[model samples]
Each structure stands twice: as C-alpha cells, then as structure tokens.
Target: MDLSGGTLEIVVSAVVISISVPGNILLIYCTRRCIDEQLRTSFTLIFSLAWTNLIYNLVVNILKIVYASNVELDSAVCKVLMFTAVFTTSLAIWFTLYIALLFCSKLCRVVHPPVEAACKNYQKFHMVLVFTLWVAGVAVCCPVLLYTRRIEKLNTENETYQQFSSLIYTECKTEYRNDLIEILYGKIFLGAINLLPLLIMLLTGFRIVYLLWEHRKATYGGIWIGGDASELEVVRACKIILLLIFVITSFCVSYFSLVYCLKNFKSCYFAPPVLTVLSSGYSSVSPYLLMLINYKVIVRMRCFCCKDEKKLVTVSAIAPVSPYA
Candidate 1:
C-alpha cells in the first residue's frame, strides 16, 4: 500500500505507545514499593493515570495501525474505540487533577476529608472518589461517540484519508447518512468532553496554588511538606520539579485539545505530526521526572530494599556490685 498517512500515524502513535507502555509499568512498580502512606492517594492517582495512559495509547495506536492499513470495522467497533480513546484520556487528566488536589489538601489542609489519614478505610473513600471520576469520564465520552463516525474518503490523486475516521459529516457531499440530532450531540461532546473539564482542571490547579499561599503555607515552594523540617530543602527541590512538569503538561494538553477542536469543524486542518509526537511524549517524561526530583520518594525507595549500616566498635567492662546486695 502506498501509505503516507499510515506512516505518519504509525510514527506518532509509535512514539506514544513506546513511551507509555513501559513508563506506566515502571510507575506502578515505584508506587508499589513506596512505604510512605502520606501521599498514597496522590501517588495512586498518578499510578492510575499512568496505567490508563498506557491502555489508551495502546488501543488508539492499534486502531490507528489497523485502520491505516485499510481495515474496516462495524459501527459498534467504531463506537467502542472512539469512546475508549476519548474517555480514558479524559480520565487520566481528571484523575491527575484529583492527584493535584489530594496533595494540595495535604499542603493547605483545605477540605478535611471524612476519613482519617491513611487508615485501612481510607482506601474505601479513595475508591469512591476515583470511581466517581471514572464514571464522569465515561459519561462525558458518550457524547463523543454519538457525534463522531468512522469515515472513508478520497481526495485528489486518489489519496485516501481512511484513518481520518472522525469527520464533520454535516457537509459531506456523499450519501452517508447524517443526523441533525447527532450534530447537536457533537456540540455536547465538543463542550463537555473537550472544553468544560479542561477549564475545570485549570481552575482547580490555580485555586490550589492560591489557597496554599493564602494559608501562609507553601511560601517558597508548593503547598505542603509535612516531614522533617530540615528535609524542607529537599522537599523544595521536588516541588520545583513537580510544578514545572505540571505546568508544561497542562499547557501541552490544552494546546492539543484546542487545536483538535478547532480543526474538527473543517474537512481537514493542521495535523502536524511533530506536535502529535510531542503531545505523546508527555506520558513518558512525567514518571521519570517524579522519581528524579522526589527526595522523600528516593529515601523511601532506599529504605524498602536496603539495610541501614551503622558499624561501631565494642568494648567490654565489668559492672560494680550494689552495696545493699
């Protein structure tokens, strides 16, 4: 097959898959070995996001490959793939915000949680919170699947855009069935899936930072650092790294989402392959950055697998007898 688009899709998707698969697995391992329960929920959210990103990258890339190779799927399969790809990415970002909030709560102690700290039952509350997030992501995705369709078309020179599966069918000249209700449905997806949640995440991060400063904590660095005061130096280091990564990742995601939405209105807009690779690269970089800059995490890592060495000399001496005895 003379496949230019397929090549581009594979190149971009390959980068996404390669980075995400191992990155998530390693992040899961790191989380498992961590002993500090203080940031457990935050790390759990990161872990969940990393793993979900892996799944999304794998599924979407495989479909990209299969579809690029001219493989066809029924409406049901198309619906499932689109729903999953869109939903899971949203889930990853939403849960990541929850991660940020969990940390901010610790730093600012803003909303006192119903459960006590790091108790066995704490996980119960955690599950409820995470599940609600998952449900919300899926619910938002429903509109995307309803509005979108897997389409095939031929441009000049018989060049095909098969994997350009999603299209605004309202203006499609061919006899492919288009529904007015679905167009309205597209607006729902455009707002809910892409715009509203994104705005919420951005605002949540800002509110968290503001609250931290307002409370007179997180002055030099981030919201909170609860351990040894002397360790505050290391904590400050970690905070700088984390905040920088968070800011960068947020910008990339926002930029990509804005472009994706604006481009969707027309037949085809800019699909810069390089930008796709850059967006996909974020997943791989995030976890390593965490491990690299987090001093407490590193200390805990050493504790998990290593024994303390405090070698010393011994001297023997006789004890004096008690006068009464």
Candidate 2:
C-alpha cells in the first residue's frame, strides 16, 4: 500500500491538532489559575501565546486535515480557510516576538533596577498591544481572502484517470491579477512575515542569553556563592527565560526548514506533509513547556494526586508561594 502525501498530511495534521488544542487550552487554564491564586500578571504574554497556538491548531491544522482528506469546498470556504490560517500563523509569530520583547525587558530590569517601575507600567498596556497585533494579522491576511479562488484542472498525469479520459481536481490558489501587487506581496510582505519576526526573536534571545551569562558571572564566578533571596530569584528567572528562548529558537529553526523546503524543492512529493509537521512542531510542543514554567500546573497535579492527605499537612507542605518568594 502506497501512503500518499495527502494521506500523510491528514494523519499528521489530525494528530497535531488533537494534541495541541488541548495542550494550549490546559496552558490557558493553568495561566489563569496562576493569575487568580498567585496574583501574577506575567502570564499575559504566555496566555496570548497559548491562545494564538490554540487558534492556529483549531483553524489551520484542522483545515489542512480536511483539505488533505479531499473534502470539497467552495471558493468562499477555501478563501476563508486560507485567510484564517495565514492570519493565525501571523498572529503566532507576532505573539512570539512580543514574548521575546517582554523577556528582554525583564532582563533589562535586572541590569537597571530603576526601570522596573516603568516596565510594570508599560505592561499595563499589553492588552492594547495584543488587540493591535490581532488587527495587524487581519490586515495582512486580507489579500489572501481577496485574491484566493478555487481552480480546477484535469488530472492528466494520473494513470488511473487514463481510462476515464479526464478527471477534474480542484484547489484553492491565489490569483495575482497585477504583477506589481504580486511582487510586492510575495517578495516584501510575505518575506517579512517569514523572516523579520524570527530575526527579532533570534537577536533578542541571544541578547537575553548574553545578559544572563554576564549577570551570572558577576554574581557567581565559578563556585557557589551564597546570595540573598533576590539573587536566587533572579537566577531562577534567568533559567526560565533561557528555557523559553530555547523554545523560540526551536520554532525558528523548524519554521525555517519548512520555508526552505517549500521554496527550493517545491516538487518533492514527500516534503509537504513533512513540512507541515515541522510547521506545527513548536505549537504542539511549546504549551507543555510553558505549563512546566507556570509551576501552578505541577502544584495542582500534586494536589489532585494527594487529595486524601491531611489538610494541615498539605497547607504546611505545599502552600502556594509567590514565584519571587
């Protein structure tokens, strides 16, 4: 039995969506629990990230599965799916950039404590920023809806179709009515979407690592130096920041692989589904990492497992502690 590209895509996309959607929802729930119980608003970017991932999995991957399964769709439906998929993908990229920026700002505070107040005040505007990012996503994807149309062509290459003489195959494709618009949208707009945000994430992630290294070296050269609680807190924060940076780096590398394959080897029969898996690699994986960073999820899981424990012992042993504490 030959496993075709479309079959592989359907299987991979279905698995990815099934896993990522629930993981992102759980991350959101964990983030909310942290906020309500621990009074930590730092979950803002994390929540936004999870939400965007959820949307991408729900919209993009699900549609990919449907398309892979050869479901018939009208031009309108195809346009909507393509536009939504692109919009959510763009939103995910922007949210990652926002997270990198936020972490960078937090590290800046470690260098100059005086900026802490300004950072907190700035964070108060995160909601407005998120809303603006969503608007930008919609604007960028508008062309996809406008230019996309369903096209049908004869499957002349198919040996099975030889007996039938002709078989029609349909696909949703962008129609560039204007050459200038095509060049601008393809070379400039889509180029930025693919490269710019990832570059920002890369630069910020490396800068963060450098700053953390310097801080760690200045505080603890080689051996264990007994430091105050704030110093310890900074170390923990640096570790978490490093973990998230690693996640971002993975996302960049995987997405770059997909883009590179599509651009250079478009004719490869096995590449598309493999690239789709790579494309969703980060979204499916990052939520669990973020949940681990939240700490609340671990505590909640422990509480559920030890529900029969004495209340006094539980309170004394596992009482919620401030992240900085």
Candidate 3:
C-alpha cells in the first residue's frame, strides 16, 4: 500500500523509538549490573553503541517525525538537526565496526589460545578507544554542520521541490559554494565515512564467522556435552556476535540501496520513505538483536530464582561412593 511521506516517516520513527529506547536502556542497565570485569570491558563497544542509537532515535528520529508534516524550522536548527543525525549515524556505524573487530580478535583466540591473554590486556583500553571514536565521528561530520543550509523554493513552473505542505517548504542541503569542494565532499568524503565502515564490517564479519565455524568443528562437533561451562559461554558469545553482524549486514544492504535510488531516481516519489526506512531500520532492529543476548541475563536470573535447586543439582551430579568393609 502506498503511504504519504509524513505517514511513512512517523511510522518508521515510532517503531524505531519504541524498540531502541527501551532496549538500549535495558542493555545499559544490564551491563552495569554485570559483575565480571572482563565481560563488562568486552561490552564497552556495545554499551556505547546502544547509547548512540538511543540518542539518535530519541533526538533525530523524533525531530524527523515532527518535521515530516512541513513545519518550518530555522536554518540553523535544521543544520544542527541534520548534522546531529548524520554524526550519530556515522558514530553508530563506527561502533559496530569496532564491535566486529573485537569479536574477530576474540575469534582469533580460539585458533591461538595464547593470544587470549594478550587480548585481555587490551580490554582495559576499550573505553579510551570508544571515546576517541566518538570524537572522530564528530570531526568527520563537521563539514555537514558547516556546509548545510536550509533552502526554500517556490513550486511554480519547475517541480524540483517536492510538496511538503500546502504552503512554503524548506530542506537542509549541503552548500559548499564550490563545485570542486562539493564534488570532493559527495564522492570522496561521503563515501569514506559511509562505505568504509561497512567494508570493514563485512570483512571482519566473514572472518569472524569462518573462525567460529572452524572452532566449533574442531571442538564441539556441533553438540554441547555436559559439564563444559566454558564451551557454553563461547557458544553464547558467538551467538550474540552473529546477531550483531546480522544487523550490520542489513544496514549495509538498506543503505546502499537508498544511495543507489538517490543517484538514479532523485525525483522519485518513493525516495523519502526509502530514506526514512534506511536511516532508521538498523537502529530499530539492533536493539531487539541485543534483547536476544539475554541468554546470559536469563542464566544469571535463574541462579537467583532457584539457588537451592541449583545447589542440589550440583551436589547430586557427584555420585556417592560406598566404603568397603
């Protein structure tokens, strides 16, 4: 069914906000409650990712929904909004890349167990790395803040401007004022920021999957035998990382599709809705992917829910030996 731009944007934003906000919050809460220092350090990228997506959904998507109905906004406000959205989106992608790299590093440990100790040493520096990435995202997108200007055009003879409302309409667009600069920004700068992370993600993702498969084939034989808690932990961690890769893969597909549409069908009626879905889909779906990582959370809660029963199980697992006379 065909839907209006405003309707489509609002629907997509509403769905994203509903899932991202609470899911990120729960992720943050659970991460904080975690007692293992190593595990918490491992989640540094994840926690940052959840935080970035939460802000993007709450601030950018909400504003997009409000502005969808052709409300006039000041040029400065428009630039700030657009810049923030782009910055957060880039930040989110970079964080996902970082996570992919982290998992790949962990997967390497399965092949070279001695490397595990070295990997653990770097865990202490993850927060610093995450902070640097946040700074880098802002710096990379700084051109957006400087070059964007909201322009309003009359819809008289030429139909370059889409109908936003019954009256005047404005759009935030890059105005580098130089053909060379605009071309560089569009082709080089934009491609680096948007496509580079995606390439890294795909590379790291495939390596991670391959390493995981090889590890499983050599170790587990595709079945979990009893009394191997470490094996269980490795399986759970791999599942969570796989879920994250799925989210990134989806974003890569959606984003490139939208980019292709913009280049070829700039004036298509479906562009706006496609843009809306492309921008918001990953943020929306990733949180639920995170919610699925609650396997650890469930196990933690189970320990509290039936402590005595668990203790009994542990005790009974050991067979009693009779003394001979």
Candidate 4:
C-alpha cells in the first residue's frame, strides 16, 4: 500500500505536533520558573527558543494539516504558513547559536580572566541582541509573504501534475517575481539562516571541546585541586551543548540536501515526508535535550515528585523520609 503526498504530510505533521507541543510547553514552563536575577539572561534565551519552537509547531503544522486534507484554503493562508516556517526556523537556529556562543564565552572566561570580565559586560546587552535577531528574521523572511501563493490544480488529468503531485503540496507554492530576485534571495536566506550559523556553531563546538580536554588534563595532572561541583556542572552542560550542535547540524544538512535534490531532479517522490521530518526535527527534539542539563528544572521536578510521594505516605502508620528531601 502506498500513501499519497497529502497523507504522508499529514502523518508527519501530526507526529511532529505530538512531540513538539508538549515538550516545548514544559520546557517553557520550566525555564520560566527557573529564571532569576543571576541567570536571567541565560534562561531568557532558552525561554525564547522554546517559545519560538512552540509557535512554529502550532502555526505551521496546524496549517499543514488543513492544507493536506485537500480543503480549499485562501492564498493568504499559504503566505502565512510559509512566512511563519521561515521566520521561526531562522530564529530557532540563531537562538541555538547564541547558546553555543554563551557556553564558549564561559569557557574562554575560565581560560582568560580578561575574557570573563568582558563577558560580564556583554551579558548586559543580551536582551537587546535577542530583539535584534527577531527584527532581522522578519526583514529576511518578509519577501516570502509576497512570493508565496496558492497552487491550483486546474486539470486533474494532466500527466505532469499527476506525476509531481506526490512531491509538492497542491495548495501552496512559492514563486519570486524574477529569476534574479529568486537567486539573490535564496543565497542570502540560506547563508544567513543555515550556512553561516552552522559554521559558527561548528567552530564554537570545537573550541568548547578543546577547552574541556585541557581542563581534564589539568585536573588529572594535579594542577587543579579538588574540582568544584560548579566546574563539574559546566563540564556536563558543555557536553550537552556538543550533543545539541550535532543534532542541529545533522538536521540542517539533511534538509538542504533533500531540498537540493527536489529542486534539481523532478522525480524525487520520497522527498516530501523526509523533508517534513528534517524541517521540524530539531525544533521538536532540542527542548528535551536542554531540560536534561537544567539543574534547577531537574531539582524542581524531583521535589514535586517527592511531595506527591509524601502525600501518599500519610495514609501509612509510619511515613518514610524521602531521599530527595
């Protein structure tokens, strides 16, 4: 049995929504509650990324479901969907890169006291930086609003339409005013959102790895005595950051490769479902990974569970003390 393109899209969208919605909501709730005076700037970035992912999943996937059902939607719906997809994805990528840079700065601070002093000053401007990213994303993706239009299938019996229908949504498509505009916009959009950020992440990830290796060698050689718990936590967080870089990089590479194939070779029938997975995969997955290294969130959850367990123990003749407490 073979599924149509619409069916494939609906299945993929549904799965992404199921995972992304709850994960992002919980991530947002946890990060919001954990924010404080000292960690305000850092957790703010996490909160923003979670918020962006949740919005993307809700807007894009819901619209995709409606479109895939073959319901006749207005051209504006297509424009909103495309614009949201591009804008949200760009914001998510830049936010993740921001996080990697934050970790790199911390590691540099450890290696050079002057760098740490500079980072302390830089922290004051983080909110402004975040605002700028949002504005920049809007500027880059605004053109998409004008170019995207509803794709109409006028003749159902057309051989070309039947052949390529499995690979594209019959309701929405993007068309620039001219080839030059399309080429120019494509290069700038791809470079800014995907290629350049990916390159920076890779470089930052390498710097983090080298710093950790150096720290470990020093600790083992007895140059640094009795590693502090905070230092250990930083090491753990850096490792998680490396994992995140890997996840985002893999998805980025897969998405662009499939997109290239679809554009160049018109017979890429399997591209739709795979492209859907690649497009939303990182957004759906990264929140949970961030939660793993969030000590405050972990502690709060444990305390909540312990309280529930204590409530159950009240019915017993003798209550057991919780290890968590």
Best by lDDT: 4
Worst 10 residues of 1 by lDDT: 316-325
Q: What are the per-residue Cα lDDT tens digits for candidate 4 across 1-325?
A: 1365667778998999999999888888877876766666668888889999998999988887776566678888889988998899888889999988886776655544362333334546888998898899899899889899987666666675455454235557788888888777865555567778988999999999998888877778787643555555566677888998999899987777666645643234455566778888998999988886557765554554576665432311222211110
Order the candidate numbers by lDDT, best to worst.
4, 2, 3, 1
Indicate whether candidate 1 or candidate 3 has the larger TM-score.
3
In the range 31-75, model 1's lDDT, one tens digit per residue, is 666524554555567667767767776776666556545566655
Write the residue-wise lDDT of candidate 3 on 1-325 in tens digits.
1255456666776877887787777776655564255455455666788888888888877777777756677678767777878788888788877766765665565444563345225555777788888898888788888888877754576453354231111366667878998778856887788778787787777787787777666666744332244434444565676777777667666776666545644345455556666777777777656544434443434444477873523211322210000
Better of 1 and 3 by lDDT: 3
lDDT of 2 by residue, 158-222 (tens): 65333221111136667788889988995578768857887887788788788777767766675
C-alpha root-mean-square deviation, candidate 3: 7.1
lDDT, each prediction: 0.53, 0.65, 0.64, 0.74
Candidates 1 and 4 compared: the better one by lDDT is 4
lDDT of 3: 0.64
**Model 2 accuracy (lDDT, Cα):** 0.65
Range of the 10 consecutive residues with the lowest summed lDDT in candidate 3: 316-325
- TM-scores of all candidate predictions against the true structure: 0.65, 0.81, 0.80, 0.87
Candidate 2 residue-wise lDDT at 210: 84
- Model 3 off-target regions past 4 Å? 1-3, 115-120, 158-161, 164-170, 220-227, 264-266, 294-325
For model 1, what is the alpha-carbon lDDT of residue 285? 64
